[model samples]
Target: MLETLVKNSRTSVDAGVYEIRGAARGGRSIKWKEGRAALITEVKLASPSAGWIREGADPEEIAASMVRGGADALSVLTQPLLFHGSPEYFARVRRSVDVPMIMKDIIVDEAQVAAAEALGADYMLLIQSVFDGGYAHNMDEFIEMGHNRGVRTLLEVHTAAEFERAQNTEADLIGINNRNLDTLEIDLGTTEEILAGRNTRSRVISESGIKSAADIARLKKAGAAGFLVGSGIMGGRDIEGTVREMISAC
Candidate 1:
Protein backbone atom coordinates (compact mmCIF):
# COMPACT_ATOMS: atom_id res chain seq x y z
CA MET A 1 0.00 0.00 0.00
CA LEU A 2 2.83 2.37 0.88
CA GLU A 3 4.63 1.68 -2.40
CA THR A 4 1.45 2.21 -4.39
CA LEU A 5 0.83 5.44 -2.46
CA VAL A 6 4.30 6.82 -3.26
CA LYS A 7 4.00 5.95 -6.94
CA ASN A 8 0.59 7.60 -7.18
CA SER A 9 1.77 10.65 -5.28
CA ARG A 10 4.73 11.10 -7.60
CA THR A 11 2.45 10.77 -10.59
CA SER A 12 0.00 13.32 -9.24
CA VAL A 13 2.80 15.73 -8.40
CA ASP A 14 4.24 15.26 -11.87
CA ALA A 15 0.86 16.22 -13.26
CA GLY A 16 1.04 19.44 -11.21
CA VAL A 17 -1.62 18.33 -8.76
CA TYR A 18 -1.27 18.22 -4.98
CA GLU A 19 -2.34 15.43 -2.62
CA ILE A 20 -3.96 15.63 0.83
CA ARG A 21 -1.35 14.07 3.07
CA GLY A 22 -0.32 15.73 6.34
CA ALA A 23 -2.98 18.41 5.82
CA ALA A 24 -4.15 19.03 9.38
CA ARG A 25 -1.30 20.92 10.90
CA GLY A 26 -1.51 24.45 12.33
CA GLY A 27 -5.18 24.32 13.27
CA ARG A 28 -6.94 24.92 16.57
CA SER A 29 -6.80 22.37 19.39
CA ILE A 30 -9.10 19.33 19.09
CA LYS A 31 -11.97 19.56 21.52
CA TRP A 32 -13.87 16.48 22.69
CA LYS A 33 -17.09 18.10 23.79
CA GLU A 34 -18.70 16.68 26.87
CA GLY A 35 -21.94 14.77 26.25
CA ARG A 36 -22.07 15.74 22.59
CA ALA A 37 -20.71 14.01 19.54
CA ALA A 38 -18.72 16.40 17.39
CA LEU A 39 -18.57 16.07 13.61
CA ILE A 40 -15.20 15.59 11.89
CA THR A 41 -15.90 16.29 8.23
CA GLU A 42 -13.58 14.93 5.56
CA VAL A 43 -12.29 16.78 2.52
CA LYS A 44 -11.92 14.17 -0.17
CA LEU A 45 -11.19 14.43 -3.89
CA ALA A 46 -11.47 10.85 -5.16
CA SER A 47 -11.24 7.24 -4.09
CA PRO A 48 -10.09 3.97 -5.63
CA SER A 49 -13.54 2.42 -5.67
CA ALA A 50 -15.74 5.49 -5.61
CA GLY A 51 -13.78 7.52 -8.13
CA TRP A 52 -13.93 11.34 -8.07
CA ILE A 53 -16.18 13.10 -5.57
CA ARG A 54 -17.29 16.39 -7.06
CA GLU A 55 -14.71 16.57 -9.81
CA GLY A 56 -12.36 19.47 -9.38
CA ALA A 57 -13.53 19.96 -5.82
CA ASP A 58 -11.52 22.74 -4.21
CA PRO A 59 -10.03 21.75 -0.85
CA GLU A 60 -10.24 25.25 0.60
CA GLU A 61 -13.86 25.63 -0.42
CA ILE A 62 -14.79 22.29 1.14
CA ALA A 63 -12.97 23.14 4.35
CA ALA A 64 -14.71 26.47 4.68
CA SER A 65 -18.07 24.88 3.97
CA MET A 66 -17.54 22.22 6.62
CA VAL A 67 -16.62 24.81 9.20
CA ARG A 68 -19.62 26.93 8.25
CA GLY A 69 -21.73 23.77 8.47
CA GLY A 70 -20.60 23.31 12.10
CA ALA A 71 -17.91 20.68 11.80
CA ASP A 72 -15.76 20.50 14.93
CA ALA A 73 -12.70 19.32 13.01
CA LEU A 74 -11.62 18.56 9.46
CA SER A 75 -10.15 15.22 8.43
CA VAL A 76 -8.44 15.27 5.04
CA LEU A 77 -7.75 11.99 3.29
CA THR A 78 -3.99 12.03 2.79
CA GLN A 79 -3.43 8.65 1.19
CA PRO A 80 -2.38 9.21 -2.40
CA LEU A 81 -3.12 5.85 -4.03
CA LEU A 82 -6.45 4.70 -2.70
CA PHE A 83 -7.84 8.10 -1.82
CA HIS A 84 -6.22 10.25 -4.54
CA GLY A 85 -5.25 12.74 -1.84
CA SER A 86 -1.96 14.46 -1.04
CA PRO A 87 -0.02 16.03 1.83
CA GLU A 88 0.01 19.36 0.06
CA TYR A 89 -3.79 19.50 0.13
CA PHE A 90 -3.72 18.95 3.88
CA ALA A 91 -1.36 21.90 4.39
CA ARG A 92 -3.46 24.14 2.18
CA VAL A 93 -6.69 23.18 3.91
CA ARG A 94 -5.20 23.75 7.36
CA ARG A 95 -4.16 27.23 6.36
CA SER A 96 -7.62 27.89 4.93
CA VAL A 97 -9.71 26.65 7.86
CA ASP A 98 -9.84 27.31 11.59
CA VAL A 99 -11.15 23.89 12.59
CA PRO A 100 -8.74 21.30 13.93
CA MET A 101 -7.35 19.21 11.08
CA ILE A 102 -6.67 15.49 11.24
CA MET A 103 -4.30 13.72 8.86
CA LYS A 104 -6.33 10.75 7.60
CA ASP A 105 -3.81 8.38 6.12
CA ILE A 106 -2.71 4.77 6.40
CA ILE A 107 0.16 5.61 8.75
CA VAL A 108 2.71 2.75 8.90
CA ASP A 109 5.96 4.39 9.95
CA GLU A 110 7.31 6.88 12.46
CA ALA A 111 8.61 9.01 9.60
CA GLN A 112 5.03 9.58 8.46
CA VAL A 113 4.16 10.73 11.98
CA ALA A 114 7.11 13.16 11.93
CA ALA A 115 6.05 14.41 8.50
CA ALA A 116 2.52 15.00 9.73
CA GLU A 117 3.77 16.96 12.75
CA ALA A 118 6.09 19.02 10.59
CA LEU A 119 3.17 19.81 8.28
CA GLY A 120 1.25 21.22 11.32
CA ALA A 121 -1.19 18.36 11.75
CA ASP A 122 -3.22 18.52 14.95
CA TYR A 123 -4.05 14.80 14.88
CA MET A 124 -2.72 11.61 13.25
CA LEU A 125 -4.83 8.57 12.50
CA LEU A 126 -3.27 5.13 13.05
CA ILE A 127 -5.34 2.26 11.72
CA GLN A 128 -5.06 -0.82 13.93
CA SER A 129 -4.89 -3.17 10.95
CA VAL A 130 -1.78 -1.43 9.67
CA PHE A 131 0.06 -1.30 13.00
CA ASP A 132 2.28 -4.21 13.98
CA GLY A 133 0.74 -4.47 17.40
CA GLY A 134 -2.45 -2.66 16.41
CA TYR A 135 -1.38 0.36 18.48
CA ALA A 136 1.14 3.20 18.26
CA HIS A 137 3.74 1.24 20.23
CA ASN A 138 4.21 -2.14 21.85
CA MET A 139 2.15 -2.79 24.99
CA ASP A 140 5.20 -2.82 27.29
CA GLU A 141 6.36 0.56 25.98
CA PHE A 142 2.96 2.14 25.45
CA ILE A 143 3.95 5.73 24.95
CA GLU A 144 2.07 8.40 23.04
CA MET A 145 4.91 9.38 20.73
CA GLY A 146 2.77 11.51 18.43
CA HIS A 147 1.01 13.22 21.32
CA ASN A 148 4.34 14.34 22.78
CA ARG A 149 4.95 16.21 19.52
CA GLY A 150 1.62 18.06 19.91
CA VAL A 151 -0.20 15.65 17.59
CA ARG A 152 -2.87 13.42 19.03
CA THR A 153 -3.34 9.88 17.72
CA LEU A 154 -6.67 8.34 16.84
CA LEU A 155 -6.38 4.57 17.15
CA GLU A 156 -8.74 2.87 14.70
CA VAL A 157 -10.21 -0.44 15.77
CA HIS A 158 -12.65 -2.79 14.05
CA THR A 159 -13.02 -5.68 16.42
CA ALA A 160 -13.26 -6.41 20.12
CA ALA A 161 -9.70 -7.76 20.22
CA GLU A 162 -8.40 -4.63 18.55
CA PHE A 163 -10.43 -2.54 20.95
CA GLU A 164 -8.82 -4.43 23.84
CA ARG A 165 -5.39 -3.64 22.42
CA ALA A 166 -6.35 0.00 22.02
CA GLN A 167 -7.12 0.14 25.73
CA ASN A 168 -3.53 -0.76 26.45
CA THR A 169 -2.16 1.99 24.24
CA GLU A 170 -2.03 5.59 25.44
CA ALA A 171 -4.12 6.92 22.59
CA ASP A 172 -6.16 10.03 23.34
CA LEU A 173 -8.93 9.06 20.93
CA ILE A 174 -10.42 5.72 19.88
CA GLY A 175 -11.97 5.47 16.41
CA ILE A 176 -14.36 2.64 15.69
CA ASN A 177 -13.87 2.09 11.97
CA ASN A 178 -17.05 0.50 10.68
CA ARG A 179 -15.57 -0.53 7.38
CA ASN A 180 -13.31 -3.56 7.33
CA LEU A 181 -10.13 -2.67 5.50
CA ASP A 182 -9.61 -6.15 4.12
CA THR A 183 -13.04 -6.40 2.52
CA LEU A 184 -14.04 -2.74 2.36
CA GLU A 185 -17.40 -3.78 3.78
CA ILE A 186 -19.15 -1.48 6.20
CA ASP A 187 -20.87 -2.65 9.35
CA LEU A 188 -22.64 0.04 11.32
CA GLY A 189 -23.00 -2.28 14.29
CA THR A 190 -19.25 -2.32 14.86
CA THR A 191 -19.41 0.78 17.01
CA GLU A 192 -21.97 -0.75 19.32
CA GLU A 193 -19.99 -3.96 19.55
CA ILE A 194 -16.75 -2.25 20.51
CA LEU A 195 -18.31 0.01 23.12
CA ALA A 196 -20.37 -2.79 24.54
CA GLY A 197 -18.25 -4.27 27.33
CA ARG A 198 -15.35 -1.90 27.56
CA ASN A 199 -14.21 0.40 30.34
CA THR A 200 -12.49 2.79 27.99
CA ARG A 201 -11.78 6.29 29.27
CA SER A 202 -10.54 7.57 25.96
CA ARG A 203 -12.84 9.64 23.79
CA VAL A 204 -14.62 7.59 21.10
CA ILE A 205 -14.90 8.58 17.44
CA SER A 206 -17.26 6.67 15.16
CA GLU A 207 -15.78 6.30 11.70
CA SER A 208 -17.19 5.19 8.31
CA GLY A 209 -20.62 3.80 7.37
CA ILE A 210 -22.28 6.91 8.73
CA LYS A 211 -24.84 7.89 6.08
CA SER A 212 -27.36 9.99 7.97
CA ALA A 213 -27.94 12.18 10.99
CA ALA A 214 -29.75 9.30 12.66
CA ASP A 215 -26.58 7.28 12.43
CA ILE A 216 -24.76 10.09 14.20
CA ALA A 217 -27.44 10.18 16.85
CA ARG A 218 -27.18 6.45 17.36
CA LEU A 219 -23.44 6.60 17.79
CA LYS A 220 -23.72 9.56 20.12
CA LYS A 221 -26.08 7.53 22.23
CA ALA A 222 -23.42 4.84 22.26
CA GLY A 223 -20.97 7.35 23.82
CA ALA A 224 -19.08 8.38 20.73
CA ALA A 225 -17.34 11.71 21.25
CA GLY A 226 -17.15 12.45 17.54
CA PHE A 227 -18.06 11.22 14.06
CA LEU A 228 -15.37 10.70 11.37
CA VAL A 229 -17.44 11.17 8.24
CA GLY A 230 -15.72 10.79 4.89
CA SER A 231 -17.74 9.17 2.10
CA GLY A 232 -21.10 10.42 3.26
CA ILE A 233 -20.00 14.01 2.95
CA MET A 234 -17.65 13.49 0.02
CA GLY A 235 -20.23 11.46 -1.91
CA GLY A 236 -22.94 14.03 -1.47
CA ARG A 237 -23.82 16.66 -4.09
CA ASP A 238 -23.97 19.39 -1.46
CA ILE A 239 -21.12 18.53 0.86
CA GLU A 240 -21.49 21.60 3.04
CA GLY A 241 -25.24 21.35 3.47
CA THR A 242 -25.02 17.62 4.19
CA VAL A 243 -22.49 18.27 6.90
CA ARG A 244 -24.69 20.95 8.44
CA GLU A 245 -27.65 18.62 8.55
CA MET A 246 -25.57 15.88 10.15
CA ILE A 247 -24.34 18.30 12.82
CA SER A 248 -27.87 19.57 13.48
CA ALA A 249 -29.05 15.99 13.78
CA CYS A 250 -26.39 15.41 16.39
Candidate 2:
Protein backbone atom coordinates (compact mmCIF):
# COMPACT_ATOMS: atom_id res chain seq x y z
CA MET A 1 0.00 0.00 0.00
CA LEU A 2 2.79 2.43 0.87
CA GLU A 3 4.70 1.69 -2.30
CA THR A 4 1.63 2.26 -4.46
CA LEU A 5 0.97 5.51 -2.69
CA VAL A 6 4.49 6.77 -3.24
CA LYS A 7 4.34 5.86 -6.90
CA ASN A 8 1.11 7.76 -7.48
CA SER A 9 2.41 10.81 -5.62
CA ARG A 10 5.48 11.11 -7.87
CA THR A 11 3.28 11.81 -10.88
CA SER A 12 2.46 15.32 -9.74
CA VAL A 13 4.59 18.22 -10.93
CA ASP A 14 7.49 19.30 -8.76
CA ALA A 15 6.22 22.28 -6.78
CA GLY A 16 8.90 24.31 -4.96
CA VAL A 17 12.30 24.52 -3.35
CA TYR A 18 12.68 24.35 0.42
CA GLU A 19 14.34 22.19 3.08
CA ILE A 20 13.17 20.97 6.49
CA ARG A 21 15.61 20.97 9.40
CA GLY A 22 14.76 19.34 12.73
CA ALA A 23 13.55 21.52 15.59
CA ALA A 24 16.31 20.29 17.89
CA ARG A 25 18.83 20.07 15.05
CA GLY A 26 19.30 23.80 14.40
CA GLY A 27 16.54 24.34 11.84
CA ARG A 28 14.01 27.15 11.98
CA SER A 29 11.85 26.68 15.02
CA ILE A 30 8.11 26.95 14.40
CA LYS A 31 7.05 30.23 15.98
CA TRP A 32 3.85 29.15 17.68
CA LYS A 33 2.49 31.94 19.82
CA GLU A 34 0.71 31.23 23.08
CA GLY A 35 -3.00 30.39 22.60
CA ARG A 36 -2.71 30.67 18.83
CA ALA A 37 -4.75 28.08 16.95
CA ALA A 38 -2.90 27.43 13.70
CA LEU A 39 -5.33 26.97 10.88
CA ILE A 40 -4.13 23.94 8.85
CA THR A 41 -5.63 23.87 5.39
CA GLU A 42 -5.29 20.48 3.73
CA VAL A 43 -4.28 20.05 0.07
CA LYS A 44 -5.93 16.90 -1.21
CA LEU A 45 -6.80 15.68 -4.69
CA ALA A 46 -9.00 12.79 -3.62
CA SER A 47 -9.68 10.36 -0.76
CA PRO A 48 -10.93 6.81 -0.23
CA SER A 49 -14.43 7.99 0.61
CA ALA A 50 -14.78 11.21 -1.36
CA GLY A 51 -12.78 10.13 -4.43
CA TRP A 52 -12.09 13.64 -5.75
CA ILE A 53 -12.21 17.02 -4.00
CA ARG A 54 -11.96 19.22 -7.08
CA GLU A 55 -11.51 18.21 -10.67
CA GLY A 56 -8.02 19.30 -11.76
CA ALA A 57 -7.70 21.73 -8.90
CA ASP A 58 -4.43 23.61 -9.28
CA PRO A 59 -2.41 23.08 -6.12
CA GLU A 60 -0.76 26.50 -6.29
CA GLU A 61 -4.07 28.24 -6.84
CA ILE A 62 -5.72 26.45 -3.94
CA ALA A 63 -2.76 27.13 -1.65
CA ALA A 64 -2.81 30.82 -2.48
CA SER A 65 -6.52 30.92 -1.82
CA MET A 66 -6.03 29.27 1.55
CA VAL A 67 -3.42 31.83 2.63
CA ARG A 68 -5.57 34.71 1.42
CA GLY A 69 -8.41 33.24 3.49
CA GLY A 70 -6.28 33.49 6.70
CA ALA A 71 -4.62 30.13 7.29
CA ASP A 72 -1.70 30.13 9.70
CA ALA A 73 -0.28 26.94 8.30
CA LEU A 74 -0.88 24.33 5.59
CA SER A 75 -1.22 20.55 5.87
CA VAL A 76 -0.67 18.79 2.57
CA LEU A 77 -1.82 15.19 2.28
CA THR A 78 1.02 13.26 0.60
CA GLN A 79 -0.25 9.71 0.94
CA PRO A 80 -1.08 8.56 -2.57
CA LEU A 81 -3.13 5.41 -1.96
CA LEU A 82 -5.69 6.98 0.33
CA PHE A 83 -5.58 10.69 -0.44
CA HIS A 84 -4.20 10.90 -4.03
CA GLY A 85 -1.61 13.38 -2.73
CA SER A 86 2.12 13.53 -3.25
CA PRO A 87 5.32 15.07 -1.92
CA GLU A 88 5.43 17.10 -5.09
CA TYR A 89 2.14 18.68 -4.14
CA PHE A 90 3.63 19.76 -0.84
CA ALA A 91 6.67 21.26 -2.57
CA ARG A 92 4.33 23.23 -4.80
CA VAL A 93 2.22 24.40 -1.90
CA ARG A 94 5.36 25.44 -0.06
CA ARG A 95 6.44 27.55 -3.01
CA SER A 96 2.99 29.10 -3.29
CA VAL A 97 2.50 30.05 0.35
CA ASP A 98 4.69 31.44 3.12
CA VAL A 99 2.96 29.69 6.03
CA PRO A 100 4.54 26.66 7.64
CA MET A 101 3.84 23.45 5.72
CA ILE A 102 3.07 20.19 7.51
CA MET A 103 3.30 16.85 5.75
CA LYS A 104 0.21 14.81 6.72
CA ASP A 105 0.75 11.05 6.35
CA ILE A 106 0.58 7.70 8.14
CA ILE A 107 4.28 7.54 8.90
CA VAL A 108 5.53 4.06 9.86
CA ASP A 109 9.31 4.47 9.86
CA GLU A 110 12.21 6.89 10.17
CA ALA A 111 12.81 6.90 6.40
CA GLN A 112 9.44 8.58 5.91
CA VAL A 113 10.55 11.27 8.33
CA ALA A 114 13.66 11.87 6.27
CA ALA A 115 11.53 11.97 3.16
CA ALA A 116 9.20 14.55 4.70
CA GLU A 117 12.13 16.78 5.56
CA ALA A 118 13.73 16.28 2.19
CA LEU A 119 10.46 17.44 0.67
CA GLY A 120 10.57 20.67 2.71
CA ALA A 121 7.99 19.92 5.38
CA ASP A 122 8.23 22.04 8.52
CA TYR A 123 6.06 19.54 10.39
CA MET A 124 5.10 15.86 10.19
CA LEU A 125 2.11 13.95 11.59
CA LEU A 126 2.23 10.64 13.49
CA ILE A 127 -1.11 9.04 14.25
CA GLN A 128 -1.16 7.31 17.66
CA SER A 129 -3.74 4.74 16.57
CA VAL A 130 -1.35 3.45 13.91
CA PHE A 131 1.38 2.81 16.46
CA ASP A 132 -0.77 1.69 19.42
CA GLY A 133 -1.69 -1.62 17.76
CA GLY A 134 1.99 -2.51 17.21
CA TYR A 135 1.82 -1.86 13.49
CA ALA A 136 5.51 -2.57 12.86
CA HIS A 137 6.55 0.92 14.06
CA ASN A 138 7.42 2.82 17.20
CA MET A 139 6.23 6.38 17.84
CA ASP A 140 9.08 7.23 20.19
CA GLU A 141 11.74 6.42 17.61
CA PHE A 142 9.84 8.31 14.92
CA ILE A 143 9.46 11.39 17.09
CA GLU A 144 13.13 11.30 17.99
CA MET A 145 14.07 10.93 14.36
CA GLY A 146 11.82 13.82 13.31
CA HIS A 147 13.23 16.05 16.01
CA ASN A 148 16.71 15.15 14.90
CA ARG A 149 15.81 16.27 11.40
CA GLY A 150 14.46 19.59 12.68
CA VAL A 151 10.87 18.71 11.85
CA ARG A 152 8.21 19.25 14.48
CA THR A 153 5.80 16.41 15.20
CA LEU A 154 2.04 16.44 15.48
CA LEU A 155 0.80 13.44 17.44
CA GLU A 156 -2.75 12.57 16.39
CA VAL A 157 -4.95 10.81 18.92
CA HIS A 158 -8.55 9.57 18.82
CA THR A 159 -9.18 8.35 22.36
CA ALA A 160 -8.07 8.87 25.95
CA ALA A 161 -5.72 5.89 26.00
CA GLU A 162 -4.04 7.08 22.85
CA PHE A 163 -3.81 10.57 24.24
CA GLU A 164 -2.09 9.26 27.35
CA ARG A 165 0.30 7.22 25.25
CA ALA A 166 1.22 10.26 23.19
CA GLN A 167 1.74 12.41 26.28
CA ASN A 168 4.41 9.99 27.40
CA THR A 169 6.45 10.86 24.33
CA GLU A 170 8.25 14.11 23.45
CA ALA A 171 5.47 15.21 21.10
CA ASP A 172 4.51 18.82 21.83
CA LEU A 173 1.68 19.38 19.33
CA ILE A 174 -1.36 17.20 19.93
CA GLY A 175 -4.13 16.70 17.40
CA ILE A 176 -7.50 15.47 18.60
CA ASN A 177 -9.02 13.73 15.63
CA ASN A 178 -12.80 13.42 15.67
CA ARG A 179 -12.83 10.85 12.86
CA ASN A 180 -11.95 7.28 13.78
CA LEU A 181 -9.45 5.97 11.22
CA ASP A 182 -10.79 2.43 11.35
CA THR A 183 -14.46 3.37 10.91
CA LEU A 184 -14.16 6.97 9.65
CA GLU A 185 -17.04 7.91 11.97
CA ILE A 186 -16.90 11.51 13.25
CA ASP A 187 -17.92 13.02 16.58
CA LEU A 188 -16.97 16.62 17.40
CA GLY A 189 -17.40 15.99 21.12
CA THR A 190 -14.20 13.96 20.99
CA THR A 191 -12.36 17.27 20.86
CA GLU A 192 -13.96 18.39 24.13
CA GLU A 193 -13.04 15.21 25.96
CA ILE A 194 -9.46 15.30 24.76
CA LEU A 195 -9.05 18.98 25.53
CA ALA A 196 -10.51 18.56 29.00
CA GLY A 197 -7.78 16.11 29.92
CA ARG A 198 -4.84 17.33 27.85
CA ASN A 199 -1.47 18.03 29.45
CA THR A 200 -1.01 21.76 29.98
CA ARG A 201 2.35 21.74 28.24
CA SER A 202 1.05 20.25 25.04
CA ARG A 203 -0.48 22.55 22.43
CA VAL A 204 -3.89 21.27 21.25
CA ILE A 205 -5.42 21.20 17.76
CA SER A 206 -8.89 20.13 16.66
CA GLU A 207 -8.85 17.99 13.53
CA SER A 208 -11.79 17.01 11.32
CA GLY A 209 -15.54 17.54 12.03
CA ILE A 210 -15.12 21.31 11.52
CA LYS A 211 -17.35 22.88 8.87
CA SER A 212 -18.57 26.35 9.67
CA ALA A 213 -17.47 29.52 11.47
CA ALA A 214 -19.68 28.58 14.37
CA ASP A 215 -17.82 25.29 14.66
CA ILE A 216 -14.50 27.10 14.70
CA ALA A 217 -15.72 29.52 17.37
CA ARG A 218 -16.93 26.68 19.54
CA LEU A 219 -13.65 24.81 19.25
CA LYS A 220 -11.70 27.97 19.95
CA LYS A 221 -13.74 28.52 23.08
CA ALA A 222 -12.99 24.94 24.07
CA GLY A 223 -9.25 25.78 24.07
CA ALA A 224 -8.23 24.48 20.68
CA ALA A 225 -5.14 26.34 19.54
CA GLY A 226 -5.73 25.48 15.89
CA PHE A 227 -8.05 23.67 13.50
CA LEU A 228 -7.32 21.18 10.71
CA VAL A 229 -10.16 21.71 8.26
CA GLY A 230 -10.22 20.03 4.82
CA SER A 231 -13.48 18.48 3.64
CA GLY A 232 -15.51 21.52 4.56
CA ILE A 233 -13.44 23.93 2.55
CA MET A 234 -12.84 21.51 -0.28
CA GLY A 235 -16.54 20.72 -0.51
CA GLY A 236 -17.48 24.36 -0.72
CA ARG A 237 -18.18 26.01 -4.05
CA ASP A 238 -16.33 29.08 -2.84
CA ILE A 239 -13.18 27.94 -1.02
CA GLU A 240 -11.82 31.44 -0.38
CA GLY A 241 -15.09 32.75 1.02
CA THR A 242 -15.57 29.71 3.22
CA VAL A 243 -12.03 29.97 4.61
CA ARG A 244 -12.43 33.72 5.31
CA GLU A 245 -15.63 33.02 7.16
CA MET A 246 -13.97 30.37 9.28
CA ILE A 247 -11.15 32.72 10.18
CA SER A 248 -13.60 35.49 11.04
CA ALA A 249 -15.55 33.17 13.32
CA CYS A 250 -12.40 32.11 15.09
Q: RMSDs, each prediction?
A: 4.1, 4.8
Which TM-score value belongs to model 1?
A: 0.85
Best by TM-score: 2
Clashing pairs in 2: 15-92, 21-150, 22-149, 22-150, 22-151, 23-150, 37-225, 37-226
Off by over 4 Å in 2: 1-36, 197-199
Error of 1 at 22 (Å): 13
Look at candidate 1 and tell me the lDDT of residue 188: 86
**On residues 1-250, what C-alpha lDDT tens digit does candidate 2 reach at each position?**
3333333433332222122333222243346656555677887777766788776888889988888888777889876666877667877777667778788877765656877777767889988877676553667888888887778899999998887777788996889998877777889888887778455568778999899988888888878888999988988888888888887765
Model 2 / residue 233 / CA error / Å: 0.7
Which tens-of-lDDT digit does each residue in 24-105 have in candidate 1?
3353567766556788988878866578876778888888888988899999877676687777788888778777888887
Which 10-residue span in candidate 1 carries the lowest summed lDDT?
134-143
Q: Global CA lDDT of candidate 2, please?
A: 0.75
